[model samples]
Target: MLITIIILAISAIFFVSGKIRSDLVALCALVALLLCHILTPEEALSGFSSSVVIMMIGLFVVGGAIFQTGLAKIISSRILKLAGKSETRLFLLVILATAAIGAFVSNTGTVALMLPIVVSLAMSAGMNPSRLLMPLAFASSMGGMMTLIGTPPNLVIQDTLTAAGYEPLSFFSFLPVGLVCLLVGIIVLMPLSKLFLSGRKKREDDAKSGKSLKQLVNEYGLSHNLFRLLVTETSKLAGSTVIELDIRRKYGLNILEIRRGDLSRHRFLKTIAQKLASPDAVLQANDILYVTGDFNRVKEFADEYAVSILDGHATEETNRNENSLDFYDIGIAEIVLMPTSLLINRTVKEIGFRDKYNVNVLGIRRQRDYLLRDLGDKRVHSGDVLLVQGTWNNIARLGRDGTDWVVLGQPLAEAAKVTLDYKAPVAAAIMLLMIVMMVFDFIPVAPVTSVMIAGILMVLTGCFRNVEAAYKTINWESVVLIAAMLPMSLALEKTGASASISNALVSGLGSYGAFALLAGIYFTTSLLTMFISNTATAVLLAPIALHSAEQLGINPVPFLFAVAVGASMCFASPFSTPPNALVMPAGQYTFMDYVKVGLPLQIIMGIVMVFVLPLLFPF
Candidate 1:
């Protein structure tokens, strides 16, 4: 008992600090339990092959297939267009769209796909990307709250209820409370969000910040280099094509890409400049070109040609040649990395970033509260914003091409038009059917098995263009996290720790009856969700909650519902949900922002579940 207590205490510390990877922490706990003989070796490894584990893998494949096909992008574009461009309109629309789709799909998957588009739209609208990103993330969470198929937590509860001899919940069983919670959450977030959120500056203004780029970079223990050149209307380069631009010969430079309109790059055109049609290809006002060359050459070229270099870099000494720095209405902005970023503890110099990504880390956004200091010398953190300057095209392209990097609502070019395998819809339809069968009891296969089989069928049918893409879609972190944590949960039960904890609660709240039990269950799940993946939290707690029911001599319905609701309330922390993580980069939200909005909502959820669970599954 004492050993189990120590392990539990250690687990709590791991959960709170999140210093080590959660999966590693869970694995360590499992190993400790196995070593102590609290659990058998087989028990320690069983979670790796559990039905939930199997199902998540399959669902991940399906989710991957959908993304590979670009169906999510298609859906997001249509929704945003319909939502109109107003910040408030877009917010509600995104929430509604995400919730509606997420209810039937994977929340994390939904967020990952939609987040890029949301950021793009916010940047286009000249609105702070953060304002809408958080709402969209929250929407994904709420949408999944509605159905058993909506999120893993709901499925866990329904499955546990089934195993305990209770009727499996219907697809919409949780809709009433879920819908209420969703609406209340949105209503509460909108007004309060502005207090912490700031709108991003306009593109024209950002273009004007070019001079300040150097100042920004200097703060990061880095320096910015500026260049100014003219794309004369008569130059063959101007009329011939972007591909034909004599970057290496005339300018002795590298053209990262060009931002013509909102597009990223065009593969068919060979080069970014080539994509512009003959007449329209002429360089017009604000036709900025991002080139990589020496700062001296850039300065000499600008001096000889009489073009403006962004003035943000100029100060007293530099101002002696201030006339040389032309303010061409061009600007640059910096975004900081918060402590949570994977980049934290890693430096741009260490990453071989320039060679690897072909983009310079011009400036650093400090991790501190204000924009006054640059993060140049400071290590990057999760929430740090980077003040980067490159050709608008290079900056945009860099963010998209790199998997490890996320762009903070920077305007970039359009995506290359690639012929998509339209069979994705058919594959998606089939997968949807599988999910429906489980929710409606139209099929006998477990939800996990059904999703896995659907994924296999999707691959077999070529619903996905390639098998490799399908494999890539599975969030391995989530899979590992779930697999690792299950063992520890089982150990807790095997060691009599779960029973001991449940009995303590039962005794303390015995007079309060099931209402008390429900709150404890709900609050515990909610708290866990804040720290770990919702699915992992649900799976880890489900068995324990079920076992606690047996020991307490009560029906497990209330307890199961508690776990269900608890796992869904991840609004309190960015770590609470993948969707949150996806948007946090672009939205520029701080850790405090999530806590401020999510904590209250989470508290309200706790209060509501206490009342709702009793009504839904009379204790």
Candidate 2:
């Protein structure tokens, strides 16, 4: 018992700290259990080939199809359009959509599909996206409570109860409690979002710089009449600097900035050439000059010398309306995609993307946790966020598409891809049908099978373009982690580890009777979930909960429900679930943000489920 406790504790630490990759941690625990004679090698490795694991893989492929087809994107955009411009209404709509989908689809999928739209909506509303994204993540988690197939925890609980000789929970058994929890969560969360989330501040920095320079100009904007010129070797002003040419006095114009290269409209050649030849070096063949505040001065300067006035790419019609048009230089910034982003496992080559939309993917920021070869060519995976770059206009465009990628923050130029056509209603209908099947037991197909079928049908119907594209839609790392952890869960069960520890627990808490025991079960499951994957914790504890019930001579139904609710309510840590991890980068959240919000929510839910579950199920 002591040895088992120690092993489980070590595994728990590894899971909770999230210091190592989850799959690796699970692998190590399985090996250790086997080496210690806790389980045979075959037993240790059995989880990899489990039906659950296979189901997950197929479902992932299907999810990828739905994502690639742009179905989710279409649904999100229409929702936003219907939301009007009200912040309250917009947030509510997002929460509703996210929760509704999350209740039936994968929780990670819920966050991945919704985050881009949330960021876009926040930008359109002139609000900081950081504030909204996290709440959206939290809301996705809350929605996962509604059905058995909503999350792995509920599934674990149902299977555990059935194995323990009790009636498995019906799909909507927890609907009332789940609805109450979801409502309470929204009410508690909305007001705190701004406090925890901040806006993209660099945009303001770019604007400030522009405004400072603009204010110094007498014309307050670029004067079209003044032609900016570059001094070449043939020009009379080629040998002149600011001091030598006395440009301000001679032409009644001040130099705004200097650059080299193309003179295209709005494309500033800010990178000046290096390697000055001499202290008194005459301006070379490519010295750009930005003269401001005077039109005739440009003509006079050009006439006096052989300098070439720069012709902008903007046409004459565009220049005519230039006064009213707000032409801010779209800035470039690097953003890291969070691990929970749906974009993981996808590549630009597959997304039908190119740089025409003003968004450019300059580069990627690969995590040190896992080594990725050929950054651009390598497929994106969970825990591998990206550093993308793009203009605000392009970022907005990408966000509105349903290609299943999340914008981490500001786009790095390399990661921005062209937006594609999305069919929202079709995607929503498919997703809705899958959820309905899971909840109402309508089709009787396995939850994972339903997801896979819907996903394939979406692709066949031209909802998405390619078969491989659909493969990129699932969170493979989470799937792998769940698979690997199953071995550890089995080890825990077979080692007599769970029964020993649970017996001690039951004896220690027997004084409080079944109610206190139920609370302990819920609290333990919830707390463990915050550290380990909820499914792992659920599987490990099911035997223990069942064992405890046998000793207490009461129905295990309430006790089992406690495990399900507890395991699913894992919002307090990033590693607890993918939704938490997904929002971290986009929301710019710290560990404390989750603790501040999730801890209390977990505590309240723990209490509620313990007291209320017994009443609902009867002890």
Q: lDDT of all the models against the reference?
A: 0.60, 0.60
Judged by lDDT against the true structure, how good is candidate 2?
0.60
lDDT tens per residue, model 1, 29-48 = 87888889988889889878
Model 2 scores a TM of: 0.54
Model 2, 450-510: lDDT tens digits are 6566766666654443465556545566566666566655665566655455567656786
Root-mean-square deviation of candidate 2: 16.8
Lowest lDDT 10-mer window, candidate 2? 268-277
Candidate 1, residue 324: how far the Cα is off, in Å: 41
Provide the TM-score for each candidate, comma-separated.
0.51, 0.54
lDDT of 2 at 5: 60
- In model 1, what is the error at residue 215, expressed in angstroms? 28
